[model samples]
Target: ANTAVKVSIDPAQDGPVINRHIFGQFAEHLGRGVYEGVWVGPDSTIPNTRGIRKDVVGALKALKVPNVRWPGGCFADEYHWRDGIGKPEDRRSRINASWAGRPEPNSFGTHEFFDFIQQIGADAFISANVGSGTVQEAADWLEYLTAQDSSLAKERAANGHPKPYEVAFWGIGNEVWGCGGPFTAEEYVTKLKQFSNFSTNHNKNMPTQQVAVGPDGDGFPEYAEVVMNAWSKRTWAWNIEALSLHRYTRNGWPPNIPATGFNQKQYASVIKETLGMNDFIKTNIAIMDKYDPEKKVGILVDEWGTWYAPTKGTDPGYLEQENSQRDAIIAALNFNIFARHADRVRGANIAQMINVLQAMILTDKEKMVLTPTYHAFRMYVPFQNAVRLKTNYDQGVYKEGDINLPKIDVISARDNQGRIWVAVTNIDPKQSIDVDLSLLGKSIASADGEILKAPTIDAVNSFAKPDVVSPKNLSLKAINGQLKFTIAPQSVSVISVKSQ
Candidate 1:
């Protein structure tokens, strides 16, 4: 038997205020994502700009990757900011490179990263090393970025740019519960408080926006709650601006370990994790409301995306997984979650921006290609400064025997330009869903859509021949007082309607 679902989007009603920060990117000192991806070293001959890749910079800007987080994931914990500065030849060398145990040269440290973000025109969110790093270290790092005039500011000018990056966002520590030290809530909070105390406007008296590592939901419920609770009690020391959570998608599918070659089962597993995000946000936000009813602290899902095992023989530290049609599905779904919960979920960064988990762009030596996830972000970029329209999903469901998952087939946005755009994703890999839009406030003029459907989930594009799987404009029809369309299964569809 087949079931029907209807998603009634009320474009007139204001849903959630979409924060541009919600659509952010992450850059870790891992794999080819940084070393070979963004920064190929100013000295390299691959066509770069001050150790940063000009092509990568152009691509990220075009995609409007609002904010880019730097330093590390777990690597941030061990990162020594001081070593990254000074002369590149004089920079320190270390083995805490990444999960792959590669050599982490601080060649592309603070100044290099800030320049990259600035050139790309995206806000820089720096995640400082707090594990092996000290409070003085964290504080000084903040000053180095924002402080205007000091021996520290002079050092920055000496390094390169005199005008400070003035970065407002700073993450205390990464996964302190896991690779980051597994510190008790009390301990982490104390450490966080201690770090925040000096790190405040100290270096050059730069204003800072502090983000403390919350208890991550690595199966721990109070992970974020504990961090929030501790922050609530602290004195004028900790200026907690955001609480972060990190979650990665894991699918038990072969050859799909490094995120390549995903079957139906693997796709479903990954889909389940992505779909579960709706509830995850609600639950996590409720916990935040426990200690913070006013929702003062911005809920930051700093690291999120599908994470299978690493690709065989590839750079393991790079976290470079194959992004396919299925991965694009995950991106659209997760983005919908962020849009739906834009209130508490102020900002979110996919695992690792380039060549990382569900990343948008993949680079190889002198060549690079855009991923499906990248397209999805670019497609949904129209919703950036727009107000989300309330969507009432149809009473329809897609189920497989005992498994029935609700379809988020309809998400609408009203841009500042007064254009009404609705993005829909069909989870059914085979059955296309019929959507009827009646409550969208008299949109009887004309309609056009874009469809991103591929032959299989694992399909990808290469630099040798890109554009293997891209979203193409779709035709639409308007009838009666309602607009009607068919969304392809396992595909992402976006439709825009014209009406006064």
Candidate 2:
């Protein structure tokens, strides 16, 4: 048996609130992410609520998704909101130049997006076009969505809904350093100021916070420096509340990593690569702190998750990739990292919610299967809006070739109702780790939750076999004032404790 890892949690210490937005979801027009993966026509045989898939909505509702960033990653830059606002048949058809030159019918537009989120009880985070759109266009779009009684609001009313939609957050652009635009940091900042100045949330009661595009990832620190530096010097009229960052985990791009059917070496490599998220968050937050010392301007990791080679015979532009146990580990590691920095790492949205990279759900016609990443998200739902508890643990090393990862990753938090929760990830693929947990200032009366694990690192849930990677019940007993439990190898376990 391996030596036991010690975990100590101080529930009395004040820590940052794990913002519910950190558990946000992303839906883009790329591939079937917004199409068949989410919106199947109301007339289709699939179970749906007004064109939105009922099963997808039902699944996401269980996770209590706080927000959904929509319209695009790169697609947002080229999208013209006007093209999607009117009658369905009158809506214009355009080619998605950023993604495989596929025909975009504009079927699932602004109205449809809000309807889907409403059904699932999520706030809207709309990404406005900046790469190929003008300031006037963006301002008008905002008015159309939030204005109480403007001409655009009337137009919106004529289209369908009589009430203005509540947009909680607005993203100015996507990856301006790359697909959003090849613009240099300086140029993008200039555009950001202009768009931010005109983009007004007409409904004063439901003010929308504006987010400017920041660096793509650690590869380009200059983007953050330039954007944050510009923000620091900005006047009251042109300020942004947050900056957006986009990063994905993969060995390298051209995405050679296969989503499934991989060796243990590849699994370790992926785990090691994903562990870099903590460093990425720290490095970017450091840059932000240099400019905004008070940390008022939050950092939203709007795009993150594992990206792999497209499934064989699938459209490469669609970014279709299978999800597995390795992806689940990646998700849990990222969640823990975000929680540790909850003060400034305000929110995050996984790359693509469905039928895309690191998706939570995958669909084939009418059949839907939850991915292992989905299970991870479901298990950690208790951490949403929960105050972080200072947790210290000794994580031993798991070595594979030159790759070294902490065998165990753990985080603890106290929810609003005073229930303490601990999320543990056993990164080792070959051995379970026994945890000797000590609640420093609390006595556990009961502990129970769920555990997600698979027999193999590459294990996945196919349409025919949906329960292969599903979560199972986990119960822990406190013996002599210490909570003891063994975490399965390559598994994620979330335990909720009620203390006396």
Candidate 3:
């Protein structure tokens, strides 16, 4: 058994409202995430809304996904908007070597993305190409997406929709540091300055936010400074709404490969790897504050979550990893991280949404099942519109072999409507943590919670039984003003406190 950690809450130092955008998801044209996952086209027998899967849309909708970043990771830079829009047959077919190395027929393009976003009720944040793409193409896309009653609007009408799809957020390029092209900070900034020149339509009063790939968050502050410096000339806020930061929970392919078939020890290692995202977001936000003092720009974790090896015999580019209880811990921890730092970190869209890396929903032909990570995202729905309250984690320690690592036990909440919520995770896989909970702001409270725990961290649900490792409701009445709670090692526990 591990010792209990105490968490204190203070309302004075409140952070930004956890943007529903922080809970946003990513959908790329790569792998099954787009083709088999989101788009099966209109000809399939499976029920779909004009080619996009209706079941998948309905599943993600229940999760309250606030925004969806589209087109690509590396594919964003290679994506030619011309190849995607207009009549289906009119769209071009190109060899996409970056993601899957297959010939991608632009069957599912910009209009399709907007249609899907509309169906899901999610804001669209499209990533523009800077590699193998141009300023004119980027400009034309912005016009096509945002223009209402002009030549661009006429083009949009000719394709299909007459109404404009207001894409509030935009990413200049993905990983301009690496796959976005190995350019120096100075080199990339020059490119960004040029891209910005074309992406803007000040004459039309078209409001759009452009995000730039930052300083290295493989973990460092230097690269962020280099990328944002080019925009110092903009006195009335950056043309970019969010500065993009792409960091995954783990580095290797099929991260669960080693832990997949192992026991508690390997499970502990895999779960611990998920906790490192806490450091990734915190350190990067600190860098952003130093450079842009007022924080007019937001830290957009556009691409995140675990990048692990594929399931055995699966296509590698598809990034089909086993989504287990450990993945749930990763979701809870990262969501809370975003909640804690909501002030500067406004938007976060996990890498690939479905049937790809760290996906929330997985499917096999028509046999679809939500992963544990999906439930965590759904459970976190309360924190979206909730006020960011000050949380004091009486830090605890989790031991892995000889290493004694400090662990954050709980995140507290005090919503705008006077409701208090605390979401806790015991990332330590070895033993349970008994916490002596207390409240600070207002006295006399009644509470309840739902906890998701399992025997091992790597446990997951297949099509056979989808109930494995899901959250179960718990009693959080805080017996006589004290809440005695035990968060199972390697699991997530959420508590809601209401004042009496």
Candidate 2 positional error at 472, Å: 0.8
User: Which ranges of candidate 3 are over 4 A from the true structure?
Assistant: 11-13, 201-206, 219-221, 233-238, 252-259
Question: Per-residue CA lDDT of candidate 3, range 1-500, in tens?
Answer: 46677776665566668777899899887777888898889999989989989899999888888888888888888888888887887788998878768789989898898889889888888889987688788888887777787898789888888877777777888887778776777787777877876785422343667888785446435567776565556645235556887777664533544425666555556556666666776777676677677888888888888777678888777677878887888888888777777888888998779988888888888878888889898888888777787777766676677656556556766677777778888777777787777667555367778988876677888889898878898755567666777777777887787654
Best by lDDT: 2
Work out the TM-score per prediction.
0.93, 0.98, 0.93
RMSD of each: 2.5, 1.0, 2.5
Give the clashing pairs for model 1. Answer: 6-394, 31-317, 31-318, 42-51, 139-199, 201-205, 215-223, 449-474
TM-score for candidate 3, residues paired by index:
0.93
TM accuracy, model 2: 0.98
CA lDDT, candidate 1, residue 204: 39
lDDT of 2 by residue, 41-155 (tens): 8898999988999999999999999999999899999999988878788999999998999999998999999999999899999999998999999999999998879889999
lDDT, residue 154, model 2: 93
**Model 1: residues >4 Å from true position, as ranges?**
1-5, 202-207, 251-258
Least accurate 10 contiguous residues by lDDT in model 2: 214-223
Alpha carbon lDDT at 23, candidate 2 = 91
